[model samples]
Target: MSDSPRTILVVEDDNIVRMLIVDVLEELEYTVLEAADAAEALAVLNNADQTIDLMMTDLGLPDMNGKDLANRAREIRPDIPVLFASGYADSVDVPEGMHNIGKPFSIDQLRDKVKGILGN
Candidate 1:
């Protein structure tokens, strides 16, 4: 609700994928925070000076799954939107209202998903 760019926390173990996501989001004028694991994402969420608008994380992480990360994030920021990115979408059953996009997603697809989630 503030007059600032919306922030998105991206968590992925794969460095290339993480970089791609961050680059795409940043190109779209979003404030992106990157983390390679759940612990790092949690640290960002817990200490962030600004509110994160959404969390777009890979489904499988090195330490924890995306669903668990989202649950933990909600505890810290109840209203934060979650967008799960996974190659195995059929395996992930997120709660209703949560957004998700499959792996190998194009930039436009990612952009649309993020915009929809943020109501842009």
Candidate 2:
């Protein structure tokens, strides 16, 4: 394994969900960074030196939606992958070719999706 940790930026407004995703990522041996909304996520993306291996964000945020956040994040880092985690999976207009994890997901599902995205 590399000395530098793989970073994942998780953007979710709910505290419990945020912590759960963080825990899962940490357990999988990736470094996890968090943001409560798109603005905060942008700040982290702007400041972090390590490449964000992937981003998992909720579609419903207090400010902008996750798709918009993903677009902005891509503008800053075009190659980074994004995953949408939302209860509104059937409703939200996600960007084409982006990945997603629906709400109320199990740990196994989350792990599988993360691994699939990271190609681990």
Candidate 3:
């Protein structure tokens, strides 16, 4: 019921994977922001002008892990939904209501998971 399209902040260090995810989310009719590392992600989260509806990050990042980033992002936007993506996601301790989709996911898999969180 929001007037603006839902916005997602995608954090992935892998260039190709990040691009693919961005493309998929855009096709799903969501506005997207992206970062290649935790620092950039933090900067975006710190921005007072942007409204991020959700965060989808790779579990393993070069600067800092996705969980930590999510924690920090929560400081900026409490209750922001989080989605983690990784091959080893089984090992992650995800927050309640948080979601995950493994790497190499099909377009449908990605769409379902993101739309489920965004409620689109």
Q: Each prediction's Cα RMSD?
A: 1.3, 1.7, 1.1
| Per-candidate local distance difference test | 0.90, 0.88, 0.90
On TM-score, the stronger of 1 and 2 is 1
Q: Per-residue alpha-carbon lDDT of model 1 for 5-105, expressed as tens digits? A: 88899999999999999999999999999999999999999985867889998989999999999999988988888999999876778876678898889
Total clashing residue pairs per candidate?
0, 0, 0
Query: lDDT order of candidates, best first?
Result: 1, 3, 2
RMSD of 2: 1.7
Report the number of the highest-lDDT candidate.
Answer: 1
Tens digits of per-residue lDDT, candidate 2, 1-120, equal: 676767889999999989999998899888898999999999988875757889999988899988888999898988879999988677766676578888989989999998898887
Candidate no. 3 TM-score? 0.94
Candidate 3: where is the Cα deviation over 4 Å? none
In candidate 2, how many clashes are counted?
A: 0
State model 2's lDDT: 0.88
Error of 2 at 93 (Å): 4.4
lDDT of 3 by residue, 14-107 (tens): 9998999899889888999999999999999999899889999998999998888888988888889999998977777788868888777899
